[model samples]
Target: MDESVRFDPKSPLFVNDPHGMLSILRERHPVLWGGEARALSGRVFSVWHLFSYADVGAALKDARLMREIRHVLTDEELGRAVPIPEEFQTLVNSQRNMMLFRDPPDHTRLRTLVNKAFTPRMVERLASHIQDIATDLLEPWPAGQRFDLVQEFAFPLPVIVIAELLGVPKADRDRIKSWSRIFTQVLDVEVSLETLVRGNQMTKDFRDYFRDLIAERRRNPQQDLISNLIQVTDDDGGQLSLEELLDMGILLLVAGHETTRNLIANAAWIMCRMPGLADALRRQPDLVPGAIEEVLRLEPPVMLTSRFLAEDLSIQGTAMKRGDEVSLWLAAANRDPAVFAEPDAFRPDRSPNRHLAFGQGIHYCLGAPLARQEGAIALKTLLTRYPRLTLAEADLTWTASTTFRSLTALEVETSAAPQ
Candidate 1:
């Protein structure tokens, strides 16, 4: 433990070039014990950063480490830290019930019910539909003109697809997108009171909207996921409760698109910087999947995820006590030299590429197949249609978030219209 290697989560250097800081941490302090700091509302919090690939991988699957919020903070502590008014108990309860924040038996049960909906076969069936959406979104962009790709394409593509999949009415998509953005702030390590309040309101809005949708689905089921989930039964022959259904809807609506949206935007930014990469993909459409994987490895949407020690554990001789939060730098792990040769280089054809972008073990991302399909189709369609795409702006602004590594806007231009 190097007492001098203190990590500031909000440092501009950390946010702008995390891979560089991660390299220093991996080499010097693979398992750094970052002492206490005031994060949420003056509540002191401690963090342990696991930077090395082997350490992070082991910590991810270690039963001694847990993701449930209760392991890190009590209900009272959470309430105090977030400081939501008593009137918003429903909001708090709904957040607490999210499958991402639950431990097993509950995690197992919730995952089991939703597993059938996201199988590779089911996601593959939507490929053509995804391509259609990409075409529809791109058709409106004028040839030889600048357009904000984040607003025009990256964000809407996934939101529209997920909303349609969930059977959400097309008219409600704008409101849903707004709510989804507000709600995602809760995932950040440093959140403001305003953000928390906005999140509560967003949760209430989602619950109200989904309640009616769930009832409609119950009365008149359709050929969509919400309808299927309404009738989905666990092995014990139990269906999702009203609250569970609502939470699931919110989760899918938000998580389904947020990361994928970033994935597409990041891929586009990378392509614009790497000359001829897009043209290469245009020449060989078969490389799209590998290109998407490379983008994920290089610029993962979600940079870090946290887990708390369920019991005292030691990693590479760094002792950690129970209840200490471990921040797994997934972005760091993805570029680990031990696993990846030329860790900093972007090689789409890098075989045996095993990145932790989707995570591992039971808590692996549920929408991975869907995200991959969307990424492949979205990037391939864009490059194939516009063979001469380039960045319209040199100064790009990234989203101000600790969890998500995303651009606020991506302006791009094409030399000509689709052939």
Candidate 2:
């Protein structure tokens, strides 16, 4: 409702071409302002968008604001939003219990349980494994031939690594993928009733599968993440509840796979467009780390985060009353001119990169190390193996997930007469 904020709900700029709108918001109104936000179904939600690095970072730093909004759902709102049947809530709740939805003490406890599993040392170990996985997947891609990187590498790499960590058989990855796709649909702001129904079934199916797996792990424990989690307990000798474990499983599967998939695809697509940067990486592989940082800055996979104003607070000269919705336009913030010089240009070796692609404050991404490792290995391996890479097709299409930004397919011609 600010006087300077302007929005065009009917314009295609609001829908298919939001980056253009975002550029306008960044240039003109970089703080709280009105704009058209889109749903998964391409429906527009009139939202007061913020594009400034300072404003967006401040919003994310607000601990009072809750990120996940399922807890405050009313019966009517839940019905319209999630579309899951009422009877299924308890079952869904059991299978999908993670720290992501909780607050304070509960979140503290849940995160404590899982945090140890993702320590820097553990991530380093996983990084080595990730490198091997990336190499194996990349080997078969007929160097000079065209292939979908998302299908062959990006999507499968993290899924396989996470699956292996969970003691999930490689044979079961397809099932995990199916369940993950359905589970993700339910997270969409606008989901089909049919998708909700199918998602409910997928949740149940995932829970049941994990239930059986846990039972087996209990009997014959293996040296895997699940076994490790089962062995650990609280001071009261209370183990992770069945619900907690199931949700963690779901979280690891989806979070482990989806984000990295997008990161890989998006980074690859961006690099393809910026041939000089890719050439730079090929020439000086040491710059791969810098390139990864730049990728995180420019086209972060998890682009948007939602926060609710927990109490009346004024920020950026705007009154934020309790219960007001605040959208953290992280993708927009990463490109804010105030933060990065030449923010839009793809520049590897760009020093002092403090982009919040992994977020900030207490709720930062737990898998930051793993994601970075996966990206570095994936990009480095591609360049090392082929030495030459080119986009096989122009006008790359993007995936339709609002929260996760990635290429639908990146058709690349590798081994193109090595530069």
Candidate 3:
């Protein structure tokens, strides 16, 4: 590893403009070995970053590159040899059970059940409702006035949609959002111990809340996902255990909205910078889906994901030992010149577009269809309603997390209020 190529993933500069740094890495060290970085729980660990289009795409589906953390580190290596702190143990256990962090049979089983609830028909069914939600959210913002797109629009839109899907009461949306935000901290590559502790508490709170909901659903079924999941049986006529249910619920609630929120906000941010782009989409609403794909390629919500080597392997001539952590830089892969023409340019009409935004292989994002629908609806509706929408400020604030490319807030103004 070249000492000059080392960069902190969590640094403000890197978080704000990762592509700039990533470009250098792709050019010189496509599969650079990035050394120790602190995880959310303040644990330091090493990682190898795959930056090239070829490397990332192959690694995403590479069976040897596994998702389960336990595959990489043994119980003793993870400090589980000694008595673990209760809060830390809760947090660790929660992550271990999450479908995102699991592999093989466990992942396949959980995903199969989830697929039943989050089907294409179900997503298509919500299209009109999603449009209505977007319309309602945009209707209140007066013309020629400014509002935070994240707070007033992007954040609430998906939160409400996912909450409704889960059968969570409207009154409890705020609480759900709070817990989701806390839980998201642990997803970042860098986080404080304090944040981890709070996240553990939120996990417990979420578990208790959903436990009651699950019980209620059993006694009285509803048309929502929670109820459907409760009744969903496996091939053996088995059901998700209580812990599985809670973990899956948390995963759905958090993953369901966070990425969509970022996608919507990122689309708005990009349109604000490019004049007439929004109008072009408004004139041709059919182009919105392609535009969303472009945004996913340019500003992927989740920038990077980790995989551990299941066995010794030589990737692009670099030898990697078994159990070594490999960070697949999806954002960087999307911008690789070898695969994309003018990869940095935001060309909405770019065809043969195969971006790794939703990932590749069996572990690809399950909420991808719903996210696309929500993003297209939200962006098209906003552009149609606020024709002259523009960024309120030249400089914007972004979340200081390497794993997620997100704006803390996006302020915009319209020439005239919607009728």
Candidate 4:
């Protein structure tokens, strides 16, 4: 570890400029171990932070690095962790059932079922509707007016799209969007007890809400993703459990839109910051796809992910004990010069870009297709409508989280009236 370098994910400076903060440490080490990392359950474990692209990429695919640690940890180790507050138990239970935290059979089961409902054709079909929603969000152009693009545009678009896709009704869109925001707290490395209690209540409310919805779908199936998922069964004729169904709903509702919202907002922020980038894309719309890829490479939605060592492993000659956690800095790896030429410089046209923004292996984001499409459409529509947009605020704020790289608000001001 470099004693001179400090890379605290929660610090304001790190949140504001993660790439700038990670550059030196990444150049110095492929793997940095010998520190304690805190888990959501209030347990502390020995941690290793993987910095280089090759190591992070391989570690993601390594079978020995497990996503869920409870299965491998001894009873004593599990008991040593702080117990969940009684009120927070329900949320924790539902969260545990999510595929994001599962391994092997459970992860395979959930992802397979959801994939049946989330087909490529389904995402492809939403293109026109996504464009329409984006167009309506910017109605009347708001030209010459200052608006928070995040609140007004970027955030709502994905939530509305994902909600509608999940069979949520038109009237419930606003409520679900608010719930989505609160649910993202689960991704934060350090969450306060107050937040946890409030989330407990929110959890109960949404569980009951989904319970009713799932029951209705059972009675009369609809054309939505939830209804489709309910019908999926294994070869032995087993279907998702009621608890599994509810948690899956919550996971999709939260993970579906939140990250994509960041993708769109980050891309917009980048374009505005880079003069003529938006105009160039507007002139040559074919570049939009590559531009989105570049944005994903440059400013990925989820920055870092961690895994527990299922067995003893040696990464770069450093021994990592079984049950220890390693934090893979996907954001840092994306900037690895060994893989990318001039890694920091944005090149929309850069070919053979192999960035792990959406992650890799079995846990690769299921919603990557939809996210890329949504980002492409949303940015294409926005820049097409307003070619001269620029950041309105002198300074921008980001959410304080290690897992999420989302903006608090993206204020934008148009320089002149649209032609």
Candidate 5:
């Protein structure tokens, strides 16, 4: 048996068949030692794999779990480890504008400001806009010709919606996607120098663009998220600094759209595979809310979240000192039979679904309400518009990242007439 078989980074089994592999790992060794895996950049990463429901949950909610590891690698190791170049770091730092990367008061303040922009009322209001965006994007589809649903509809719609929310320029939407794709490559364990460089440059360009956008908004304020955030004043009349503003803007642009793109693609791919479930959605549109939750449980957009232990804690009967990285596999936990009944089946009408697709406790996804709204709307629209929607081919490729799961592309045939 291949040693990497259980946790092989290169095996299709790990990539295409994570659930199955995870099942085996749980049965044999719930908390398995991954030892070290060589990165594409040739750096070795020592990871501790946690696979059970209770274990993963405890790690996520545990106060002892920290997010940053300092001095884990020796000075020599630091030299060998893939160093994010200074230029790349500078650009990446420019993007470190928002709550996703920060801790404590900063994270809390930024999240509060962002939340005000994405309130339930705000999300409901955006429904018409979302519908219009989806309609416009799909309306031009040539009926008889096959199209990649992901690239054409799933990908662009979220980008446009998020751009509108963030006050990003209409003309720069496509370029935002390009930069986002590059900047997002750091999520992979095997980070590439080229992607790091590209991601850095992308952030720099975005910062330059947003600084100008901020100045414009200050000069001539509008009704977008940027303007809303800029004008946010506390009882003491304090506002965000220039650096905070730029960071928050860049974070919203990149992380905001990236997660939803995956959610939309993953949900659609799952539905297409299960004909009955897809049919149920077509017949009962109201069931979309439940269905979205179920799909999020089965295949969450952000599959894994890691916490660097700030203090000593025990998980799955294992003791950990401060600074250990605890990875919470959301996808694995969502399907854990221990928590959810018949975890693998796609039940559209699942009741009391407590899946942690948006995570749990303090760090729950800030855009949870918005993401659900967009996903439910998109899925319902796609199914309603094309009841006969079917995959053009079944062999779709998965993106090469352990932390995130999404189809690289999914070509489909729809019932609509050729435009």
Candidate 6:
């Protein structure tokens, strides 16, 4: 296990079966510090990866670890050596403005402006529509045959839900999937130059499309999140600028689509192996929500999130310097035995589940409630539509990413007539 600590995040060993390796790392080296400079996009920085639940949870709440270092560190003080690629500037700038990448006042301001759109009441209003979309997608499937669940249902269900929520046309949802995928991929600790360049171009394309939509919403306000975002303001009359608005739209698309898609696929995959679980869910539909939580705990969508130190600090008697990057492994923490009983076991009704799937503190995912609701609805729909299911193959492959834990494709067979 000690020798396996050097394993790369994108390697086949980690992607396919990371839990077994992660459990060992958590037990042995919870605070595994890299003893060298790590380069991301040609820029170098020291990094420390936190694997234990205690360390990850505490670090997430610590204000000293800031999301946007620019808020405190000046360009001269930081002394950046490599300039960002010309093409990647749009993507970088958009990320910088997004609430996901901001700290304190900016993050608070941006999250506050859109908080109303994600409240329980708001998400509940869309429940019927989500179910309808799921039903519509499943209606065309051929019974007693093998098909790709991700391609047929899991992928498109959330896209349609979020698209309508954002007031975008259903026809246009297909175009933004690649843009969102590229955005999540480039968020890794190290990404290819080509990936960055491609992501930047897609960023520009989506920005252009969103620009027209924003303008149209301003012209004719509608009953949708986009119109609300354009017109609504905080208590202090704070409104999002054109750049901020565009970035917010991009962030919503990425957050809403990717996580929910994986959540549904992962839940279905787990159920296929659990004997009589499908009948249990159908008999007791209320178990679907609890089952979803168990899935989130066992396999989170976002693996790890990074924060930079605002000032020099020490943790667990380990000396750390200012500006050092800390990667909090949420996937590792969610599976830590110190917190969960039989952390690896798939117990659908596991109570008091305190999984940090959506993270914690100021940077907690804003779309969490919506994502959970979408997951529950999607799973229930899948269970109703397909009474019998089995994995298309035994060996499964995940996407090539360290940031996202997603299936490359989930092929499921429901070789029974649709219920």
Query: Model 2: per-residue lDDT, tens digit, 1-419?
Result: 45765655234334334466677776776656455555323333334556778888887776777754444333343344544466456435644366665666777777777776456776777777888888889888867887888889888888888788888977898999878777766665455767777777787889899989999999999978888777777666656787788888888787767788888887788777777777788889898988898888877887777776566667667665554566677888898888799888877868899898888776678888888888899999887776567899877666565566667777888875666
Q: Write the per-residue lDDT of candidate 4 for residues 270-372, one digit (tens) a residue.
A: 9889867887898899999999999998898999898999888898888778889889999999999999999988888999999999889989999889999
Off by over 4 Å in 3: 37-45, 73-80, 417-419
lDDT of each: 0.84, 0.74, 0.87, 0.86, 0.74, 0.84
Which run of 10 residues does model 5 get worst, by summed lDDT? 66-75
| Per-candidate total of colliding backbone pairs | 0, 0, 2, 0, 7, 0
The per-residue C-alpha lDDT of model 2 at residue 41 equals 31
How high a TM-score does candidate 4 get? 0.95
Measured with C-alpha atoms, the lDDT of residue 198 in candidate 2 is: 79
Could you tell me how far off, in angstroms, the CA of residue 103 lies in candidate 3 after the best superposition? 0.9
Residue pair clashes in candidate 1? none
Instruction: Sort by lDDT, best first.
Output: 3, 4, 1, 6, 5, 2
Off by over 4 Å in 1: 37-45, 69-84, 417-419
Worst 10 residues of 1 by lDDT: 37-46
TM-score for every candidate vs. truth? 0.94, 0.88, 0.95, 0.95, 0.89, 0.95
Q: Ten residues in a row with the worst lDDT in model 6?
A: 35-44
Q: Give the Å error, residue 235, model 5.
A: 5.1
lDDT of 5 at 329: 74
For candidate 2, give the lDDT.
0.74
Model 4, 317: alpha-carbon shift in Å?
1.2
> Which of the two candidates, 2 or 4, achieves a greater lDDT against the reference?
4
